[model samples]
Target: MNKKTIITILIALVAMAGQAQKHLPAFQYSKEPAVLSGQIIGNNQQITESVHVRYSLKYTSGMGDALRQTSAAVDADGRFTLSLPTGTTVDCHVAVGECRFICYVVPGQTVTFTLDLNKLETQGLANALTFSGQLSDFNHDLVYATEQGIDPETIYRDIEAKRNMGQLANELPEKSEQGYFHYLDSTYQRVNELIDNDREIGQAYREFAKAVNRYEWGAMMPFCGQSIQYAGIDTDEAYDAFEARLKQRLEVYMKDDPWANPVLCYVMWSMPETFVDSYVSHPVKLPTDYQQCHLASKFLEQMGAQRFLLTEVQKDSVLTFLPELAQDVLDYNERMERELSFVSEQGMSRVCTLPDNADDILATILKPYNGKPVLLDLWETTCGPCRLAFKDMHDKKKDLADRIHFVNIASENSDLATWQRLIPNYIGDHYRLTKQQLQSLHSQLPCNTSGVPIWVLINADGTIHHAFTGWRNVDDMMKEINQVLQ
Candidate 1:
C-alpha cells in the first residue's frame, strides 16, 4: 500500500474510535468515599424536610448478618449530602416521604441531582429532575428506562408473587420450566436492548445494569423452585430438570463477568439452600482472576454457613479452592469476624421467674426494674429479622446500657434450647413466657400488631410510654427513648 493510502486509513480509524468513545465513557473504580449531594426543587415542605438517603451495604454474600446501612439527612434548604463507603460501584435509593427512587454511585466521585416533589407526587416520575457531575448520563438513562415501563421492581414483584402464590401471575402463559425460562429470556432481552440502544448510557453502568438483570433472571428458577418445594408441589424429576437447565444458562451468563458487579453479589447471596447445595455439589469453574477468586471465596463461606455450621476445616477448605486469592479471602474473613463479634464474652443473661397468672406476666417482667425506664423487646429465636435487629442494635445498646434497662421477652413459640443458645449474643434481661401468658401480655399492651420484634417503652414509673412492632434504626429508637427518659 502507498503512504498516502495508509495515512488516509489511519485518520479514518482515529475518527471512528473517537465517535465510539463519545458514546461509551470510561469509568474507574476507587476505595475512597463517594458523595451524593442533591436538592429538593419543589414546594412540598413535608417531603423536603423529611427526605433521607438510605442504602444497604453488602460487601459479602452473608448479608443477613453482614448487611449494614448508611443514611444521611436533608437540611431545611432541601440540600443533602451522603458519603457512601464503597470500593467499586453501588446502587442506592433516595427516599422522600413514602416514595423512593434508585441512583447509581461510585467511590471518590460526586453525583449531584434534584428531586421535584410535585412531579414525583402527581405523575410518579423520579427522573433526574436535573442531573450533573459524574455518572449523569448513566443515572439519566436508568431513570428514563424505569419511567418507560422497564423497571426492576416489576420483575422483582413477579418473582415475589410466584414464591408466595406458587405460580406466576403476570406475563407467563404457562407455569412449566420452559415457560418460566422463556419469561426470563424475554425480559432480559428487553432490558438488554434498552441498555444497548441507549447511546447515552456509559460503558461502566451499561455493563453493571446488564449484569444485575442477568443474575436476577438466572436466580428466579432456583428461587421459585425452592418455594414450590416448600409448598409440596415440586417433584424430584421436575426439580432435577429445572436445576440442570439453570446450570446450563448460568454457564453462558458467567462468561460475561457477571460477578464483577457487586449488586449481583447480593442476588447470589440471597439464593435458597437447595440452590447453594446444588452449586457446591456440582461446582462451576469461575474465572481465576483476583475479583473472581475473591467472590468465589465469599460465596463458599456464605453457603457453608447457610447449609450447615462451618468449622475451621470447612473455612480452610475455602482457602484451598482459591490458593492464589488466599490473602484476599483471609482479609475479608478477618474484617467480618471483627464486625460480627457481637457475642459477649461476659454473660449478660439475667434469670427471671415467671408469674403463674397469665395477666400478671407483663407486670412481673417489669417489677425488677421499677425506678428505671425499660425497653422491652418481644422477639423469638426462630425469627431471622429478630436476630438481625439484635445484631444491628448491639453496639447502640451497650452505649445506653447504664442509662436504661434493656429487657427481652420470648414466648413458647421459640424453642427453649435455641433461645438459651442465642441469648448470650443478645445482652439483656431475658424472659421466656408461656403461650397464654404472652397472649395476655399482648392484650394489655397498646401493640399495633401482634408480631415479633415488638418494642414496648416503659417509663421509669412503670407506665407504658410507647408500644410498636418491627425494627427501628438506632437514632429513631434513641429519640423515642429520650422522650420517656425526660
Candidate 2:
C-alpha cells in the first residue's frame, strides 16, 4: 500500500476507535460495581424503620430479557445501598415500604438522594419524588413532564360526561384532535428544553428519551382521535384523511428511530381495530389491498410484534392475513408450551374436571353456599380493569355481603404471589385454577369470547342467568345481579 494511503487509514481507524469507546463507557463498570444509596424519612421527618425497598432497572426500550433488578432493606436509620448495572438508560422503580416511586436513570455515576414519605403519602406514589445525581436531574424533569402531560382518562371521562349531557359540539372531533396534538407539542417543548439546557443529562439518555417520547406521543394519538364523536368522523373521506395523517406522523417517528419504541408495533397490530366503525358490521379480510399488505408485512418484520398477540382471536386474524409470518405464531405457541411444561414440572397438576369425588375441586369450591346466588369472577392478576372494577364495587359488595356469594377464580397464568397480594382487597371467596382447568371450565360457558374479566351471575335457583366480558357496564351488571336476587 502507498504510505499516504496507509497514514490516512490509520487516522480513520483512530477516529472510529474513539467513537466506539464513547458508546461503551458502561462496560468499564462491569468490573467495578455501581452503588445507589439513599435515605428514607417519614411524615414526622424521622428515619423509618424496617422498610423494604426494591427497584427494577430495565432498558428504556427492549425485550423482557434486558431487565436488571436490584433491591435493599433500609436499616432503622433509614439508610441503605444497592448495586445496579451501569451504562444504559433504565426505567427504575424504587419502593420504600408500601410506597413506590418511578424514575429513569443511567447508573454508573454515584447516586444519593432522600425520599420524603410525607410528600409520597399525600401526593400518591406516582412520579411525585424528584432525584439528584449526575443524570438524575434530567430524569427527574422527564418524570415531571410525564406527570404534566395530558391524562387519557381525564379526556375520556370528559368525552363521556359531555356525551351524557348532550352538550358535545359537532366540532368535538376536530377539537379533540387539536387537544391531543397540543399536549404532544407541549411535552416535546419541555423535553427539548431540558436536553438543550441541561449540560449533565448526557447524550445517551437524551437520544433515548427523545425517541421514546416522540413515539409514545404518536402511539396515543389514534386512541384520542377515534374517541372524538359528536358528529360522525367515521365517514370514509374523513376517516381516510385522519388515518393518512396519523400514518404520516408515524412514518416520521419510524424514520427517526425504529427500534427505540414499541408504538409502531402497537399501531400495526391494531390495524384491524381501525376499521371497527366502518367495516366491522360488514365482514372484511385483512390486508385488503397491496398497500396495506406491504405495510403490515414490513412492520411485522421490523418490530417482531407477534408477541403482542396473546389471545387466540388476535393470532388467528394475523395468521389468516399474512401467511408469511407463520413463524411468529409458532414461536408464541412454543412459549406457551414451555410455560405449561414448567408449571407441570413444578408439581402443579391441572385437573380438568370436577373430580367424581363429590369432594371434587369445582364442587367443593361452590358447595359452601349451595342454595344461595353466586357471582363468579374469572380474572387474572395482570388484568388492570378487573382490579379496578372489583375495587369500585367494594362498598357495594360489602352491602350485599349477606345476600350474594362473591366467588373469584383467578386464571392459572397469574403468579401465586400477585394473587395473594391482590385477593385480600376483594370481599369474596377466592380459588386459583391452572390454564388447562380454566380452559376446560370455559368450554362449559355459553359465551364465545375468551377475554377477561368475565362475570357470571347465577340465579338463586343455581342456573346461570347472565355472562359477559369486560367491567365497563356497571349498571348493566347491577341489573343482572338484581334480577338474580329477585
Candidate 3:
C-alpha cells in the first residue's frame, strides 16, 4: 500500500479507539428515547431509598419543561428503571438527595434535579432552593436540575417554604431571585385556579396583590382596616363575598401548603384601592366615619382572622389608634425584657427555637452578657466567614479584652459535645438558643445583627451602641467598634 493509504488507516484506528473510550452511551434521545436503568447500593436493607429523577430538555436550554419520575425499591440488589422522554434530551436527579443513583442514559442531554425529602426539609424552610445545580447561570442551573421537565408549581412551592421560613427574603428582584417571584406567581396562579369556582375570591386576591405591589404598606393597611368597618356597614358587599371566597379557598389550600407568605400577585389583589388612594403622609385621624371605614376589620375580627395577620401586616392598619398599639408593643417589650432578665441570670445557654417575634431578641441574648459588651459570634459548624471572624476577634482580644466581652454563640441544634470538641478548651462563654430565643433576642438588639459574624457593642448602660449585620460587612463593624471606643 502507498504511504497515504497507510496514514488513512491509522486515522481510522484512532477515531475508532476514541469512540470505544467514551464513558457515556452514544444513543441520542431526540430520535430514540428509552428507559434509563440504575441500582442504589447501600450497606444495609434499612438504608434503601426511593429515587426521584427530574428530567430536563437539552436543546431548549433550561426553559423547557422538567419532568420527574420515581423508581420502586431497587431489588434487594438495588435495581430500577425509568422511561426517558422520546425525541429529546433529558437529565434527571433525585429529590432531596433522597437516594443516590448513577444514571445510565443518552449522553449530551440536559437534566435537572428536585430536592429529596431531606434536602427539601433542609432548604424548603424559610423558602430556599432545595437543590443546587452544576451549571453556572440561572438558566443552566434550571436546565441542569430538570432537563427533562419540572413542575414550576412544585419549584415555586418549595420556594414558598423557604420564604415563609425567612430564608429567601433577602434575595431581591433578580434572576437568583426568580424563585421568589416564581413562587409568588405560582401561588397566585394556584389561588386563581380555585377562583375559577369563586370569582369573588379571585378578584379580591388580585386586588390585594395589585395594591401591595403598587402602593406602600400604609395604604393597604388602613384600607383593610376600613374594609372591616365597611364590611359591618354593608354585610352584603363584594368585599364580604370575597372574604368568604378567600377563607373557603384557604381551607382547601392551607393543608400541606405553606401560606405564611402571600404571593405578590395575591397581595396585589387584596388592595386595589391603594393605587387610587394616596397614602396618608402623617397619621390621619380616622374620619368620623372611622367606625364605618373600619367595618371590614370588625367583620374580619368576627371571622377570626384580623388578629391573625392578613389584615394587620403594617402599623397603619390599627395604628389609626396608635397609643393603644404602641402600648401593646411596649408591653410586649416589657414582658420580653423580663424574660431577658431571667435569661441574663442564666448565662451561657443554648439557642434552640425559631423566634415568634423579631423584637427583644437582643435583650434576651444580652441577659447573659449583661453589662459586658459581647462579641456575639453566631458561627455554625459550616460557616466560613464565622471562622475567620472568630480568629480575628480572638487576635484583637488582647487590645480590648477588658472592655469587650466575647461570646461564641451557636444554635442549640448543634451537638454540644461535638461543638466542645471542635473548639477544644474553649474559654469564652459558649451559648446556644433555639430559633425562637435567637430571633426574639435579635429583634430587641437589631444593631444590624441579621446574619452571623455578628459583632455588637452592647454598652454597660444596657444600651446597644452598634450592631454589624453580616460578616461581609466586617469592616463596617471595625469602624463602629472604633466609634464606640472613642
Best by TM-score: 1
Per-residue accuracy of model 3 over 313-408 as CA lDDT, tens digit each: 433544454332233333333443453344345442332332455356666555655666566566664555665454344335545666766666
C-alpha RMSD of candidate 3: 23.4
**Candidate 2 collision pairs:** none
- Across 1-486, the per-residue lDDT of candidate 1 in tens digits comes to 999999999999987754552332322235587788888766655454555565544334442534435666677778888777654455677776666677767678898888776777676664426667876766766676566655555556666776677556344676555666676778778878877887756565565567667766766655545442222336898657766767676656555555444445433434333234445434443223334434543553453223223358756875676454445446655654644354354445565668575357778888889999999999987776677677667777777788899999998898887777666557788888887887888888887646778999999999999998987566788889899878
Select the stronger candidate by TM-score from 1 and 2: 1
TM-score of each: 0.65, 0.42, 0.27
Candidate 3: 10-residue stretch with minimal lDDT: 58-67
**lDDT (C-alpha, whole model) for all candidates:** 0.65, 0.54, 0.42
Report backbone clashes per prediction.
0, 0, 89
What C-alpha lDDT, on a 0 to 100 scale, does residue 81 get in candidate 3? 50
Q: For each candidate, C-alpha RMSD in Å?
A: 6.8, 14.4, 23.4
* Order by lDDT, highest first: 1, 2, 3
